[model samples]
Target: MKNTIAERIFDFLKDFPPFDVLTAEQLIIIARNVKVIYLPKDKFVFKIEEEIHDHFYVVKDGAIGIFRKEDQVLVDECDEGDIFGLRAMIRKGNYILSAKAIEESIVYSISSLLLEEIIQTNTEANKFLIASFATNTRNPYANDNKGTLFANVKSLQKNESSLTEVQSAQYSKNPITCQLKTSIQQAALIMSTKHVGSIVITENQKPIGIITDKDLRLHIATGRFSIDDPVESIMSSPVITYPENISVAEAQIAMLQHKITHLCITKDGTANSVLTGILSEHDIVAIRGNNPSALIKEVKRAKTAETLQHIRKKVQQLLQGYVEQHIPISYISKVISAINEAITQRAILLSLEEMNTPPPVKFSWLALGSQGRKEQLLITDQDNALVFENPPKEQFDVTKAYFLSLSEKVTQKLNTIGFEFCPADMMASNPRWCLSLDEWKNQFHSWITKPDKDKILLSMIFFDYEMIYGDKNLVDEMSESIFGSIGSYKIFLNFMGLNALKNPPPLSFFRQFLVEHSGEHKDQFDIKARAIMPLVDAARLLILSNNLKGFNSTIARYKKLAEVEPQNKDLYESCINAFRVLLRFRTQQGLKNNTSGRFIDLKSLSKADRLKLKGCFKPIKDIQELIKVRFSLSHML
Candidate 1:
């Protein structure tokens, strides 16, 4: 007899991992025993501490969020072709985390018997499963045990490795140590001679206290303690200690939890045992090459635009590694943005030094568009503006001229450092963008009161303004001016809503990508204009209408929206996830082809890649509908 349902399940499973490696006979056998289950939004598939089910689940459609029981924080979100509830089944233990439907979802549950008999015996499939366990469990050590079958599973193709998180942290074996009775002066001498930031105080080879550069600055330099005083007077007692076998993640967590920068590696992972080595924050940063803190420090020390340019290249390499390693896009974006901001800040300082004299008045430099939102991953065109304190009517020209000259120098330095000048001349160097505080308020008022196509476009970019240098109060005042104008006019948000819907979801009736019909990107997909911008625009409009402030990035805005409007939390969360996927997809594509990643050739995508791209469009369409109804954009459109 024909088992059509089983055949359908087999078809879907064959496209995903583990099952993808399974033979036709083996997959069909597992699929035959699969049972389909449907869940509405917020419904629980299994609760924490529940007995392990006979089966584990694979998502067929929609999303499932795995939540930690204590905090209810969503740890991992499983989507199409994603497997869940399997870790408990594999361990034969009760569920440690709860699985809930994030939206209307269909999941296929396969018996543990089939998993043990068919999939577990296969080497490739077993490796993939172990990798999945490592990722979903958030356990850095799961794949680190060399004696376990899971060891080296990170080498599997397309598997997300914990990378530095799981690797055994390298510590300085020859730690600089001082006796508990050593004077502060002698300890300081030892630290300087060894070129180390800290020194541990030990008794019988066991760490009892630690002193760092911070201690010297606070205790001796501040005249709080004499340099001749014993180290015990200033040393922080009960030194934080870790095992020699500690992983980077464990060391980092211990540091954060204890509020310390150095960890004493001991023989038995306790301060009671012999101190074997020392691990500092700098060591961890060194392990993760292109670390944000190290990059920022380099940026500060950089003397020329050329030096900054070199650092920016390192930033690109870091981004590539993060993309390939499957790091969370949110974390990657923050790190990259911080480095970019530091570079920009350094550029401004260099430009200021070249000026004939100090600025005549206080001013703020604003980063517009993607940089403003802290979402820039690639070195793209610079969008910036400058706002100085309102000048005296008699001295307006002189004040404006001084800032314009300064702006010109800053923009040139930035361009030299690889941020190409904005093609449209929407830069601080342009007189139109270099304005007084009052002038900027009036400019914003004009755009908000009389909404038009060009103004809407400018608003989309300029409204996400973030101050890179100068008075944050000025930016805060500017924000107030913008909201005040919107509150008065009330129709600007509706206009913004209409603009957000201009680029419909990048899918057609047949569920195929809608590629560009003409132009330089003819027959290619515009991921940015079609997919990314819609989500960005929607978040901006919704957040602006709510009169909220300080939420800049699309992800941050959506997260805030989810918190404020819990009724629509699912929709907002979906938007957040979809935006992340689209952003990561664009960045990966950009890194691959060395272009802006806006246009993608459909032919180059694999079946799995295409499906992943398609998954993002649903949230885009749903959010557009919500905007249309909420802002009454239906009639306006």
Candidate 2:
């Protein structure tokens, strides 16, 4: 049996990753054979191209740097509970990079023979080995690029069909033709009846010209040509033509180069030949893909709740497509945001229609928390607030009741759609969150001026409020009030800045992750609170200090900061990149486990992923330093 020290180590490892997959007895067995090696700072464990060792290493304490000879770059750093030196073990090949202690560190070296024996029996452990050995061949968070994860590969494969077809282009098979002498009004009638955005103008069953929505708007609508004018008067002559066999990709490119959305498929591949069909961008999009915009339109036009549900299903398909394509998380965030916003707006519209009376005054719908920041991926509980215009004292109770009823109806529809009610009853349906504009302003004032820990927490949750629907003026007025309050209480930003530094990047006691010391989630890393939120809260606080409004998104704030401070441009850009990597990792993990990717089981992550994640924290440390110096927050700490 392993000693208490090794048993404790095994206990930590088992909760996190490959160790977690092993039986407790198996872990204790492996732990007994572990060589706990300590190294001084900057000591090399192994050099690049060195023969593979019989064992791999995991950071038990402190940080270890994995350096690549090429450019002498510090590829990644392995923190507490992070694995390293395993790729060589998996491949039985020489080490590709050198591993060195970045700081004073203790590493647990597990015998490869023992690992193999465990893997042969442990399916989960073996699968993890394969994953770690494959794509993680190089540091994903190297100086040059943020690494893509397993989820990226899955997302790429998923989006392949639509992306492939988009590159190839799909054309209509049925051609709507017209004689050259056909009156513009008649052609317009046919287009209207067919519900097509563009129509082909043909003569003798041959291609001639094209008339599109743009043409009609420019010529007929602008009085450049009369309704009775010959179709040739406004039709685009020598239309952009492609052969019938052109792929969707080729067709899309051809249309783009010609600056047109419609591509005519002709028999002889020329404008003079017989026209086979017209291809619209919309047709191409509908054939092989689902787009968020199309889904949004469907949501708006949906006649029934079921139809909206269908559109929501389409949104999921789009999300799957995006995730598979390895589309940037920011883009995915925006697309999801638009779809979520559309659903909420549609729900509100449906509720309004069901209501017996129009709202007495302008009221705005607010999306709180992650949804408000437009970062929600998987559906979570609804966090909403309502801000209605203040009414006379006599009508106050009545107005509040009316909005409460509306909130109840809206939240119910949202629940039906997907978003569950907030467990704490923090939703707009709650009396506290559903308030008048003046009341909200007062709330902000109280939170900022008389800030206590609870008030500060409340402010953090409430400050991220995004106006979803209703009068623009009301939202703008609310923002103005916030700025006015912040301007008077500059210390609010300092307090917020201090809050951002609360987690200290979770670097080890020796400049690495301070892994969970015990319990159910023991050794499982808390990546969210430690790595992501510090950056998020910092970005929000920093941006607010600049008096910026309506930019709650972390990336957008960094981009804005980069623009405003040219001297600190590189730092802001780095923060953006770091934030993206961490967010992407969290999302990928969340998707994999079907839970919030906040607490990461270290054993499950490949040696490379663990290192990449550790690499992301460097910028976090740097940025925290900047925040400290800038805000004079050292005293508070």
Q: Number of the top candidate by lDDT?
A: 1
The local distance difference test score of each candidate is 0.84, 0.77
- lDDT (10s digit) by residue, model 2, range 128-209: 7776664443222111122321212211122354444324356678877787888999999998998888878777777778
Q: How many backbone clashes does candidate 1 have?
A: 0
- Candidate 1 lDDT tens digits, 171-229: 99999999978999999999999999999999999999999999999999999999999
> Tell me, what's the RMSD of every candidate?
6.1, 12.0
The TM-score values for the models, in the order shown, are: 0.81, 0.64
Query: Model 1, which residues run further than 4 Å from truth?
Result: 1-3, 39-56, 66-75, 84-104, 111-123, 126-162, 165-212, 215-220, 223-279
Compute the lDDT for candidate 2.
0.77
Error of 2 at 19 (Å): 26
Model 1 lowest lDDT segment of ten? 142-151
